[model samples]
Target: MPRPQKVRKILCPPAMSGFSPYGIPATDSEPIIMTFEEFESIKLVNYEKMPQEEAALLMQISRPTFTRIYNRALNIIGIAFVEARSIQIEGGNCEFEREWFRCTRCFKLIEGLENHSKCTDCPHFEKNELTRLNPDIKDRIA
Candidate 1:
Protein backbone atom coordinates (compact mmCIF):
# COMPACT_ATOMS: atom_id res chain seq x y z
CA MET A 1 0.00 0.00 0.00
CA PRO A 2 1.15 3.50 -0.69
CA ARG A 3 2.07 5.59 2.30
CA PRO A 4 -0.14 8.51 3.24
CA GLN A 5 1.26 11.78 1.92
CA LYS A 6 2.87 13.98 4.51
CA VAL A 7 1.61 17.54 4.62
CA ARG A 8 4.47 19.74 3.42
CA LYS A 9 4.91 22.82 5.59
CA ILE A 10 4.74 26.18 3.85
CA LEU A 11 5.86 29.38 5.56
CA CYS A 12 3.40 31.62 3.80
CA PRO A 13 0.92 31.54 0.97
CA PRO A 14 2.03 32.81 -2.42
CA ALA A 15 1.63 36.55 -2.82
CA MET A 16 0.32 36.16 -6.35
CA SER A 17 -2.38 33.56 -6.84
CA GLY A 18 -1.39 32.52 -10.36
CA PHE A 19 0.32 33.52 -13.61
CA SER A 20 -0.75 33.53 -17.26
CA PRO A 21 0.76 34.19 -20.63
CA TYR A 22 -0.20 37.42 -22.39
CA GLY A 23 -1.64 37.91 -25.93
CA ILE A 24 -3.29 34.47 -25.99
CA PRO A 25 -7.00 33.80 -25.85
CA ALA A 26 -7.80 32.46 -22.39
CA THR A 27 -9.69 29.58 -23.96
CA ASP A 28 -6.82 28.50 -26.21
CA SER A 29 -5.35 26.28 -23.47
CA GLU A 30 -5.97 25.24 -19.92
CA PRO A 31 -3.63 26.46 -17.20
CA ILE A 32 -1.32 23.87 -15.68
CA ILE A 33 -1.75 23.43 -11.94
CA MET A 34 1.45 23.69 -9.96
CA THR A 35 1.07 22.31 -6.47
CA PHE A 36 1.77 24.75 -3.64
CA GLU A 37 4.50 22.43 -2.39
CA GLU A 38 6.26 22.81 -5.73
CA PHE A 39 6.12 26.57 -5.36
CA GLU A 40 7.55 26.36 -1.84
CA SER A 41 10.33 24.11 -3.06
CA ILE A 42 11.23 26.61 -5.77
CA LYS A 43 11.28 29.44 -3.25
CA LEU A 44 13.46 27.48 -0.85
CA VAL A 45 16.01 26.24 -3.35
CA ASN A 46 16.19 29.01 -5.90
CA TYR A 47 14.91 32.20 -4.24
CA GLU A 48 16.38 31.54 -0.81
CA LYS A 49 19.66 30.12 -2.15
CA MET A 50 19.65 27.50 0.58
CA PRO A 51 21.32 24.11 0.40
CA GLN A 52 18.98 21.27 -0.42
CA GLU A 53 19.69 19.35 2.80
CA GLU A 54 19.16 22.41 5.01
CA ALA A 55 16.02 23.44 3.22
CA ALA A 56 14.72 19.90 3.47
CA LEU A 57 15.24 19.98 7.21
CA LEU A 58 13.31 23.24 7.52
CA MET A 59 10.41 21.75 5.53
CA GLN A 60 10.55 18.56 7.62
CA ILE A 61 11.22 16.48 4.51
CA SER A 62 14.01 14.08 3.75
CA ARG A 63 16.86 15.36 1.57
CA PRO A 64 16.02 12.96 -1.27
CA THR A 65 12.36 13.95 -1.16
CA PHE A 66 13.28 17.62 -1.28
CA THR A 67 15.51 17.00 -4.31
CA ARG A 68 12.72 15.21 -6.13
CA ILE A 69 10.27 18.00 -5.36
CA TYR A 70 12.79 20.64 -6.43
CA ASN A 71 13.41 18.85 -9.72
CA ARG A 72 9.70 18.59 -10.45
CA ALA A 73 9.24 22.31 -9.75
CA LEU A 74 12.05 23.17 -12.13
CA ASN A 75 10.54 20.97 -14.83
CA ILE A 76 7.09 22.54 -14.50
CA ILE A 77 8.53 26.05 -14.47
CA GLY A 78 10.58 25.22 -17.58
CA ILE A 79 7.47 23.96 -19.35
CA ALA A 80 5.54 27.12 -18.51
CA PHE A 81 8.38 29.36 -19.70
CA VAL A 82 8.97 27.39 -22.90
CA GLU A 83 5.35 26.91 -23.93
CA ALA A 84 4.05 30.21 -22.60
CA ARG A 85 1.34 28.24 -20.83
CA SER A 86 -0.64 29.73 -17.99
CA ILE A 87 0.61 28.58 -14.62
CA GLN A 88 -1.88 28.19 -11.81
CA ILE A 89 -0.45 27.30 -8.44
CA GLU A 90 -3.08 25.92 -6.16
CA GLY A 91 -3.64 22.60 -4.41
CA GLY A 92 -1.08 20.64 -2.47
CA ASN A 93 -0.97 18.29 0.49
CA CYS A 94 0.37 20.94 2.83
CA GLU A 95 0.13 22.63 6.20
CA PHE A 96 1.26 26.11 7.21
CA GLU A 97 4.30 26.54 9.40
CA ARG A 98 3.37 30.14 10.11
CA GLU A 99 0.51 31.55 12.18
CA TRP A 100 -2.45 30.02 10.43
CA PHE A 101 -5.13 27.44 11.13
CA ARG A 102 -7.80 25.48 9.35
CA CYS A 103 -11.12 25.84 11.06
CA THR A 104 -12.73 22.47 11.61
CA ARG A 105 -16.31 23.59 11.03
CA CYS A 106 -15.82 25.89 8.04
CA PHE A 107 -12.57 24.39 6.77
CA LYS A 108 -11.21 27.84 6.17
CA LEU A 109 -7.55 28.79 6.44
CA ILE A 110 -7.11 31.87 8.60
CA GLU A 111 -4.33 33.86 10.21
CA GLY A 112 -4.49 32.93 13.88
CA LEU A 113 -1.75 34.79 15.68
CA GLU A 114 -2.48 38.34 14.63
CA ASN A 115 -6.24 37.83 14.44
CA HIS A 116 -7.14 36.74 17.99
CA SER A 117 -6.62 33.03 17.27
CA LYS A 118 -10.31 32.31 16.75
CA CYS A 119 -11.92 31.67 13.41
CA THR A 120 -14.46 34.39 12.70
CA ASP A 121 -16.08 32.36 9.93
CA CYS A 122 -16.95 29.31 11.97
CA PRO A 123 -20.53 29.02 13.17
CA HIS A 124 -19.45 26.95 16.15
CA PHE A 125 -16.36 28.98 16.96
CA GLU A 126 -17.13 29.02 20.67
CA LYS A 127 -16.88 25.22 20.69
CA ASN A 128 -14.23 24.70 18.04
CA GLU A 129 -10.75 24.07 19.41
CA LEU A 130 -7.95 26.23 18.14
CA THR A 131 -4.31 25.36 18.00
CA ARG A 132 -2.61 26.91 20.97
CA LEU A 133 -0.37 29.91 20.43
CA ASN A 134 3.08 29.71 21.90
CA PRO A 135 3.46 31.83 25.01
CA ASP A 136 7.22 31.95 24.48
CA ILE A 137 6.87 32.60 20.75
CA LYS A 138 8.09 36.18 21.01
CA ASP A 139 11.02 35.24 23.18
CA ARG A 140 12.12 32.56 20.72
CA ILE A 141 12.23 35.12 17.92
CA ALA A 142 14.40 37.45 19.95
Candidate 2:
Protein backbone atom coordinates (compact mmCIF):
# COMPACT_ATOMS: atom_id res chain seq x y z
CA MET A 1 0.00 0.00 0.00
CA PRO A 2 1.18 3.49 -0.69
CA ARG A 3 1.99 5.69 2.29
CA PRO A 4 -0.10 8.71 3.03
CA GLN A 5 1.20 11.98 1.68
CA LYS A 6 2.19 14.20 4.60
CA VAL A 7 0.81 17.70 4.42
CA ARG A 8 3.24 20.47 5.24
CA LYS A 9 2.43 22.91 8.09
CA ILE A 10 1.34 26.40 7.00
CA LEU A 11 -0.43 27.97 9.99
CA CYS A 12 2.12 30.65 10.68
CA PRO A 13 1.49 32.65 13.82
CA PRO A 14 0.37 36.13 12.74
CA ALA A 15 3.79 37.49 13.64
CA MET A 16 5.37 35.11 11.15
CA SER A 17 2.75 35.36 8.42
CA GLY A 18 4.63 35.70 5.10
CA PHE A 19 3.16 38.74 3.45
CA SER A 20 5.51 39.76 0.69
CA PRO A 21 6.07 43.49 0.30
CA TYR A 22 5.79 43.18 -3.45
CA GLY A 23 2.71 40.89 -3.60
CA ILE A 24 0.26 42.01 -6.26
CA PRO A 25 -3.50 41.45 -6.39
CA ALA A 26 -4.69 38.26 -8.06
CA THR A 27 -7.07 38.98 -10.92
CA ASP A 28 -8.01 35.37 -11.57
CA SER A 29 -11.76 34.92 -11.64
CA GLU A 30 -11.66 31.47 -10.12
CA PRO A 31 -10.68 31.74 -6.44
CA ILE A 32 -8.14 29.33 -4.99
CA ILE A 33 -7.81 28.11 -1.43
CA MET A 34 -4.21 28.43 -0.32
CA THR A 35 -3.38 25.70 2.15
CA PHE A 36 -0.95 26.25 5.02
CA GLU A 37 1.15 23.38 3.75
CA GLU A 38 1.97 25.38 0.64
CA PHE A 39 2.94 28.36 2.78
CA GLU A 40 5.48 26.27 4.68
CA SER A 41 7.07 25.10 1.46
CA ILE A 42 7.86 28.69 0.51
CA LYS A 43 9.18 29.54 3.96
CA LEU A 44 11.40 26.49 4.10
CA VAL A 45 12.86 26.95 0.64
CA ASN A 46 12.88 30.75 0.32
CA TYR A 47 12.85 32.21 3.82
CA GLU A 48 14.83 29.57 5.69
CA LYS A 49 17.18 29.19 2.72
CA MET A 50 17.01 25.43 2.65
CA PRO A 51 17.93 23.53 -0.49
CA GLN A 52 14.97 22.29 -2.56
CA GLU A 53 15.76 18.63 -1.89
CA GLU A 54 16.12 19.22 1.86
CA ALA A 55 12.96 21.30 2.01
CA ALA A 56 11.08 18.65 0.06
CA LEU A 57 12.17 15.96 2.48
CA LEU A 58 11.31 18.07 5.49
CA MET A 59 7.82 18.65 4.08
CA GLN A 60 7.47 14.96 3.15
CA ILE A 61 6.84 15.77 -0.50
CA SER A 62 8.73 15.13 -3.71
CA ARG A 63 11.04 17.90 -4.89
CA PRO A 64 8.82 18.66 -7.86
CA THR A 65 5.73 18.75 -5.68
CA PHE A 66 7.43 21.08 -3.22
CA THR A 67 8.44 23.38 -6.05
CA ARG A 68 4.87 23.51 -7.31
CA ILE A 69 3.46 24.23 -3.87
CA TYR A 70 6.10 26.86 -3.09
CA ASN A 71 5.49 28.63 -6.37
CA ARG A 72 1.72 28.60 -5.87
CA ALA A 73 2.07 29.94 -2.35
CA LEU A 74 4.35 32.71 -3.53
CA ASN A 75 1.97 33.59 -6.30
CA ILE A 76 -1.06 33.87 -4.03
CA ILE A 77 0.76 35.75 -1.28
CA GLY A 78 2.33 38.05 -3.81
CA ILE A 79 -1.01 38.93 -5.30
CA ALA A 80 -2.63 39.51 -1.93
CA PHE A 81 0.16 41.76 -0.77
CA VAL A 82 0.44 43.73 -3.99
CA GLU A 83 -3.34 44.03 -4.35
CA ALA A 84 -3.85 44.67 -0.62
CA ARG A 85 -6.57 42.01 -0.48
CA SER A 86 -7.17 39.76 2.51
CA ILE A 87 -5.95 36.21 2.03
CA GLN A 88 -8.16 33.48 3.41
CA ILE A 89 -6.63 30.16 4.46
CA GLU A 90 -8.79 27.18 3.62
CA GLY A 91 -8.95 23.52 2.54
CA GLY A 92 -6.09 21.32 1.33
CA ASN A 93 -5.01 17.71 1.20
CA CYS A 94 -3.52 17.21 4.69
CA GLU A 95 -4.04 15.93 8.23
CA PHE A 96 -3.34 17.15 11.78
CA GLU A 97 -0.80 15.47 14.04
CA ARG A 98 -1.30 13.88 17.47
CA GLU A 99 -0.36 17.03 19.40
CA TRP A 100 -2.71 19.12 17.28
CA PHE A 101 -6.46 19.15 17.88
CA ARG A 102 -9.20 19.83 15.41
CA CYS A 103 -12.40 20.62 17.31
CA THR A 104 -15.22 18.44 16.02
CA ARG A 105 -17.86 20.97 16.95
CA CYS A 106 -16.21 24.09 15.60
CA PHE A 107 -14.00 22.44 13.00
CA LYS A 108 -11.12 24.54 14.25
CA LEU A 109 -7.63 23.03 14.24
CA ILE A 110 -5.78 24.57 17.16
CA GLU A 111 -1.97 24.64 17.03
CA GLY A 112 -0.55 25.43 20.44
CA LEU A 113 2.81 25.15 22.05
CA GLU A 114 3.72 21.67 23.25
CA ASN A 115 3.99 22.95 26.81
CA HIS A 116 0.39 24.21 26.79
CA SER A 117 -0.92 20.63 26.55
CA LYS A 118 -4.28 22.05 25.51
CA CYS A 119 -5.69 23.50 22.34
CA THR A 120 -5.94 27.29 22.23
CA ASP A 121 -9.07 27.03 20.11
CA CYS A 122 -11.36 25.27 22.61
CA PRO A 123 -9.31 25.20 25.77
CA HIS A 124 -12.31 24.22 27.87
CA PHE A 125 -12.73 20.73 26.46
CA GLU A 126 -13.50 19.06 29.71
CA LYS A 127 -16.32 17.19 28.06
CA ASN A 128 -14.44 16.58 24.82
CA GLU A 129 -11.60 14.19 25.37
CA LEU A 130 -8.24 15.29 23.99
CA THR A 131 -7.12 12.27 22.06
CA ARG A 132 -3.37 11.75 21.84
CA LEU A 133 -2.60 11.40 18.17
CA ASN A 134 0.02 12.63 15.77
CA PRO A 135 -0.81 14.81 12.79
CA ASP A 136 1.39 16.27 10.06
CA ILE A 137 3.06 19.40 11.49
CA LYS A 138 5.36 21.42 9.24
CA ASP A 139 7.98 23.50 11.02
CA ARG A 140 8.85 27.16 10.49
CA ILE A 141 11.35 29.64 11.98
CA ALA A 142 10.07 30.16 15.50
Candidate 3:
Protein backbone atom coordinates (compact mmCIF):
# COMPACT_ATOMS: atom_id res chain seq x y z
CA MET A 1 0.00 0.00 0.00
CA PRO A 2 1.10 3.55 -0.55
CA ARG A 3 2.36 5.54 2.40
CA PRO A 4 -0.12 7.79 4.12
CA GLN A 5 0.07 11.42 3.14
CA LYS A 6 1.63 13.86 5.60
CA VAL A 7 -0.61 16.54 6.99
CA ARG A 8 0.53 19.96 5.73
CA LYS A 9 0.97 22.75 8.27
CA ILE A 10 -1.24 25.77 7.54
CA LEU A 11 -0.47 28.96 9.46
CA CYS A 12 -4.11 30.00 9.43
CA PRO A 13 -7.38 29.50 7.62
CA PRO A 14 -8.54 31.74 4.80
CA ALA A 15 -10.49 34.80 5.87
CA MET A 16 -13.32 33.95 3.48
CA SER A 17 -14.56 30.58 2.32
CA GLY A 18 -14.74 31.24 -1.40
CA PHE A 19 -15.01 33.75 -4.24
CA SER A 20 -17.12 34.30 -7.34
CA PRO A 21 -17.06 36.57 -10.35
CA TYR A 22 -19.15 39.70 -10.22
CA GLY A 23 -22.33 39.91 -12.36
CA ILE A 24 -22.43 36.14 -12.65
CA PRO A 25 -24.79 33.88 -10.77
CA ALA A 26 -23.01 31.23 -8.70
CA THR A 27 -25.42 28.61 -9.97
CA ASP A 28 -24.19 29.19 -13.51
CA SER A 29 -21.20 26.89 -13.16
CA GLU A 30 -19.78 24.26 -10.84
CA PRO A 31 -17.37 25.76 -8.32
CA ILE A 32 -13.70 24.85 -8.40
CA ILE A 33 -12.47 23.39 -5.14
CA MET A 34 -9.12 24.69 -3.93
CA THR A 35 -7.63 22.85 -0.97
CA PHE A 36 -6.26 24.62 2.06
CA GLU A 37 -2.70 23.62 1.22
CA GLU A 38 -3.14 24.90 -2.31
CA PHE A 39 -4.37 28.23 -0.96
CA GLU A 40 -1.40 28.41 1.44
CA SER A 41 0.99 27.78 -1.41
CA ILE A 42 -0.44 30.73 -3.33
CA LYS A 43 -0.50 32.98 -0.26
CA LEU A 44 3.07 32.18 0.67
CA VAL A 45 4.53 32.40 -2.79
CA ASN A 46 2.38 34.96 -4.58
CA TYR A 47 0.65 37.07 -1.95
CA GLU A 48 3.45 37.16 0.62
CA LYS A 49 6.22 37.33 -2.04
CA MET A 50 7.95 34.42 -0.36
CA PRO A 51 10.55 32.25 -2.01
CA GLN A 52 9.53 28.71 -2.86
CA GLU A 53 12.21 27.16 -0.64
CA GLU A 54 11.25 29.33 2.33
CA ALA A 55 7.53 28.74 1.79
CA ALA A 56 8.12 24.99 1.59
CA LEU A 57 9.91 25.11 4.90
CA LEU A 58 7.09 27.12 6.44
CA MET A 59 4.51 24.57 5.29
CA GLN A 60 6.77 21.67 6.37
CA ILE A 61 6.67 20.30 2.83
CA SER A 62 9.29 19.88 0.15
CA ARG A 63 9.94 22.58 -2.43
CA PRO A 64 8.72 20.34 -5.23
CA THR A 65 5.48 19.65 -3.40
CA PHE A 66 4.99 23.34 -2.73
CA THR A 67 5.50 24.11 -6.40
CA ARG A 68 2.92 21.55 -7.42
CA ILE A 69 0.42 22.94 -4.93
CA TYR A 70 1.07 26.49 -6.04
CA ASN A 71 0.68 25.56 -9.68
CA ARG A 72 -2.60 23.84 -8.96
CA ALA A 73 -3.91 26.85 -7.10
CA LEU A 74 -3.01 29.12 -10.01
CA ASN A 75 -4.70 26.81 -12.48
CA ILE A 76 -7.86 26.66 -10.38
CA ILE A 77 -7.99 30.42 -10.09
CA GLY A 78 -7.39 30.87 -13.80
CA ILE A 79 -10.17 28.48 -14.68
CA ALA A 80 -12.47 30.19 -12.21
CA PHE A 81 -11.74 33.52 -13.80
CA VAL A 82 -12.14 32.38 -17.39
CA GLU A 83 -15.22 30.30 -16.79
CA ALA A 84 -16.80 32.70 -14.31
CA ARG A 85 -17.16 29.95 -11.74
CA SER A 86 -16.89 30.22 -7.99
CA ILE A 87 -13.70 29.20 -6.22
CA GLN A 88 -14.29 27.34 -2.98
CA ILE A 89 -11.46 26.88 -0.51
CA GLU A 90 -11.73 23.75 1.60
CA GLY A 91 -10.71 20.11 2.21
CA GLY A 92 -6.98 19.41 2.41
CA ASN A 93 -4.60 17.13 4.25
CA CYS A 94 -3.58 19.94 6.58
CA GLU A 95 -3.45 20.98 10.23
CA PHE A 96 -3.69 24.51 11.62
CA GLU A 97 -1.33 25.84 14.29
CA ARG A 98 -4.18 27.33 16.31
CA GLU A 99 -7.91 27.51 16.64
CA TRP A 100 -9.58 30.13 14.40
CA PHE A 101 -12.89 31.88 14.45
CA ARG A 102 -14.76 34.33 12.19
CA CYS A 103 -17.18 37.07 12.96
CA THR A 104 -20.14 36.37 10.72
CA ARG A 105 -21.19 39.98 10.59
CA CYS A 106 -17.90 41.47 9.46
CA PHE A 107 -16.01 38.33 8.37
CA LYS A 108 -13.06 39.17 10.61
CA LEU A 109 -10.82 36.26 11.52
CA ILE A 110 -10.16 35.78 15.24
CA GLU A 111 -7.26 33.67 16.47
CA GLY A 112 -9.03 31.88 19.31
CA LEU A 113 -12.11 31.75 21.48
CA GLU A 114 -10.38 33.55 24.34
CA ASN A 115 -9.63 36.45 22.01
CA HIS A 116 -13.07 36.55 20.44
CA SER A 117 -15.06 39.65 21.22
CA LYS A 118 -17.89 41.59 19.68
CA CYS A 119 -16.79 43.17 16.43
CA THR A 120 -17.13 46.84 17.26
CA ASP A 121 -17.42 47.83 13.62
CA CYS A 122 -20.23 45.42 12.92
CA PRO A 123 -23.70 46.66 13.67
CA HIS A 124 -25.79 44.27 15.80
CA PHE A 125 -22.70 42.20 16.59
CA GLU A 126 -23.02 39.46 19.19
CA LYS A 127 -20.57 37.10 20.85
CA ASN A 128 -22.57 34.13 19.60
CA GLU A 129 -21.94 35.25 16.01
CA LEU A 130 -18.36 34.05 16.18
CA THR A 131 -18.01 30.84 14.16
CA ARG A 132 -15.19 28.38 14.73
CA LEU A 133 -13.24 27.60 11.57
CA ASN A 134 -11.11 24.64 12.53
CA PRO A 135 -12.30 21.71 14.57
CA ASP A 136 -9.68 19.97 16.74
CA ILE A 137 -7.43 17.89 14.48
CA LYS A 138 -6.92 15.36 17.27
CA ASP A 139 -10.61 14.69 17.35
CA ARG A 140 -10.57 13.91 13.65
CA ILE A 141 -7.59 11.57 14.07
CA ALA A 142 -9.35 9.68 16.84
lDDT of each: 0.71, 0.56, 0.83
| TM-score to native of every candidate shown | 0.68, 0.52, 0.82
Query: Per-residue lDDT tens digits of candidate 1, residues 4-118?
Result: 6556667876655568888887777778888778888999878999999988888887888888888988888888878888888776666666665455555556665776457
Better of 2 and 3 by lDDT: 3
TM-score of 3: 0.82
Candidate 3 lDDT: 0.83
The count of backbone overlaps in candidate 1 is 0
How many steric clashes between backbone atoms does each model show?
0, 13, 0
What does candidate 1 score on TM? 0.68
Give residue 56's error in model 1 in angstroms. 0.4
What tens digits encode model 2's per-residue C-alpha lDDT throughout 17-119?
A: 2233334444543344467676567667778999989987776678898888888988887776565665655445544333454445444444544522454
Off by over 4 Å in 2: 1-32, 101-142
Clashing pairs in 3: none
lDDT ranking, high to low: 3, 1, 2
How does residue 1 of candidate 3 score in lDDT? 57
